[model samples]
Target: MVEVAMSNCANARPTRCIGVRVLGVSKSIKGNPVLDTVSADFALGRVSGIRGHNGSGKTMLLRAIAGLISVDKGSIEVFGEEVGVDGSFPMGVGFMIEPLELWDEFTGLEMLTLLSSLRGKFCVDHLRSTLIRVGLDPNDTRKIKSFSLGMRQRLNLAQALMGNPRLLLLDEPTNALDEDGQETICRILRDERDRGTTIIVVSHDREQLDRIADVQYVMSDGRIREV
Candidate 1:
């Protein structure tokens, strides 16, 4: 039987070190379990990596943390605040998942502009620099539909990194990148970690995970074990 915990943040208080805590989290889709009693603590100002093969519940875990999905059991707390209690995601969290759907009619710059405007944090120059940092040509006015796979991936990353989110979640962030592109992203993530950002990354690339993750976990058979 699945266990469920009522969300409560009445006593939530900022922790000096911990950024997120997952306690007995479990989820199922259409009666098939994906996450089974998963629990982990993510330290503040560090990168945590989840490595698993396809269908091992990595993405589901991330989506649950992002407040994009409801877990059938357990609790998720971000920065000491309960996730479901408020029906709103924690502030300054950014995520990039697979199957990205962009405004094909808008230019890459335009899309980023729209996102940053919603955040109300970055200016146009900052947005342009973010695009350039992700290896996209900010001056290019071509529509997103004209972009190649790798270009689109870079743009996806740009949006996630636009506002310098306090917590960043990325799944297969280097999916279509070449060696140089992958290295660039690693450097950027490392920089963000140094600046006190908490990041969670899900990837199949063991080497990349080892290089960037302060701590790592392997998910299998709907469970996660620290490595």
Candidate 2:
């Protein structure tokens, strides 16, 4: 269980520090308007959770922030840098979206190594510790294709947490976990906020979000409102 109450937790921080900002953002995919002038501010050094039904544009909002896809209108600013204009992807960002795609031939360690190599190298021990944090066995060498769904989810989380990224974007982070696994992940995410990391999470689990989110939002019909 999430035993740390928000008041008692060591998460004190300034209220005015904004990490990510979206303004009048609109997008259409294949003639479907997925994001309809959505806008919100995610506070720095906290976990911001967005709850929405499937295809409500929560994922699309994240993609716009991450520079994965360009939006048709409005601006997304991360740490005062405009996304898609300042750079393709914001610096020091780690994200794990759905579909959990990876090279089936590569082991967990190998896959993380390959991904991490893109930015730079992380110590082997660091990666190993990240794996352990995500409830994965650091010594496991099984290929990704052989991993169970829960295992794959854990791996995806491990990669997102690999470098102690300044910003973390996670979609349904605890998707395939058991009760214990879900608790561990929530604890990790809660602890990340303590470390001054900015996080934006999209989940269907309102209860689980309550455990970790410092602030919550509801999304409907491609619009967002604070909860």
Candidate 3:
């Protein structure tokens, strides 16, 4: 967890060690500005939370950090390496965004297997254990099309956690979950932080953020400020 406040230096750089750095990041969509010269630092091995009303650019910031969208100005760096310039994306990143695209024809286990194959690291046993860890039955052969919203959310989380990423970007991770499910997700997030994963979460639930976030920020009018 973040234990110290980072210094506001003359360079506008964070003094504490950082996992990711956003320097003057700005983005516009169809001529409407979404992120306006946002600057922030995410400390390594800490849980950072972003909260905001709808269309405040919380999701857009996460997307930009995840390398899913291009920024119109400034730069993003992960562990001191600039994204898109150093490489396409930061190493060991896991993310879950809305409209999760899944193969409706494939079983849940099969979907995990396919995604794991892309990384060429995890095996069948690893995938099965991840499924169970997320409270899903690995043996269930039901196609993804048959999954309910909550179940799909769990599956999405399972996939994000499959390989134990070093950086996690979760947008509304508790959405569609019951109280118990929410607790389970929170527990898993804590465990991940304990394991030194840098996590960035975007959620509307202030209580949830208070529970898990080591540092919190609020987004408004295409800008971000710590709170």
Candidate 4:
């Protein structure tokens, strides 16, 4: 039987240090700029919110920091180490992108199991705790093909939280969640920050960001300014 923790999991990071630092990063596609000359610093033990109107390059910026997109200019560093064009952010960083695609044929547990196996890391108990954290039912062996949007969103979050990521890059994490689900995610993020993980949440949910973020960034037309 899978053991689901009745409460939230403990924080993985217990020490304070700088987490993510971005410097003059820029990215463009098809000669059109999405993010231009962006720079920021995400400190340890804080939940930083990135907010912008539609088409403001908020998601693009997060993806750049996560090493998902190639920067046309500038650099990104996590814990003082440079993250190059290749999608590498050391071993401790984790990221969740938009569209949260998962293998429909695989059950949630199966998906996580496969991912963990890819890294030769076995932690069934950790996987179960993460599933529980996102309000997923570990015992439900149903494949992801049958999961609702909200269920898929939760599962995406669970996968990102696997292996106790030190720097979490989230894009619209609360998009498909209900009020309770949103609250739970906020709680988890706060708990992680308290434990010394730096978080960068990109979302349009102003109310939620206001409640959880220590500071907020407003991105518009590929430019960023602290709000």
What are the candidates' C-alpha RMSDs? 7.0, 4.0, 3.6, 6.4
Off by over 4 Å in 2: 1-16
Give model 3's TM-score versus the native structure: 0.92
Pairwise lDDT winner, candidates 2 and 4: 2
Question: Once all C-alphas are superposed, what RMSD does model 4 give against the true structure?
Answer: 6.4
- Writing each residue's lDDT as its tens digit, candidate 4 over 1-227 gives 00121122133342124577778988889989998898887766578999999989998887777777678899888777777635565567767878766999999999999988876575899899899988998989899999988899899999889988878989999888899889889999988876777789999889989989988999999999898
Candidate 3 yields a Cα-based lDDT of 0.89
Winner by TM-score between candidate 4 and candidate 2: 2
Q: After superposition, how far is residue 110 of candidate 4 from its true place, in Å?
A: 0.3
The C-alpha TM-scores of every prediction are 0.91, 0.91, 0.92, 0.89
List, residue by residue over 113-176, the lDDT tens digit for candidate 1. 8877778758989999999899999999899999988899999999989788889999999998
**lDDT at residue 155 of model 4 (Cα atoms):** 92
Best by lDDT: 3
User: Mind giving the per-residue lDDT tens digits that candidate 3 earns over 36-108?
Assistant: 9999998888899999999999999999998888899999998787877744977789999666798999988
| Candidate 2, position 112, lDDT | 87
Candidate 4, overall lDDT?
0.82
What TM-score does candidate 4 get on C-alpha atoms? 0.89
lDDT of each: 0.87, 0.87, 0.89, 0.82
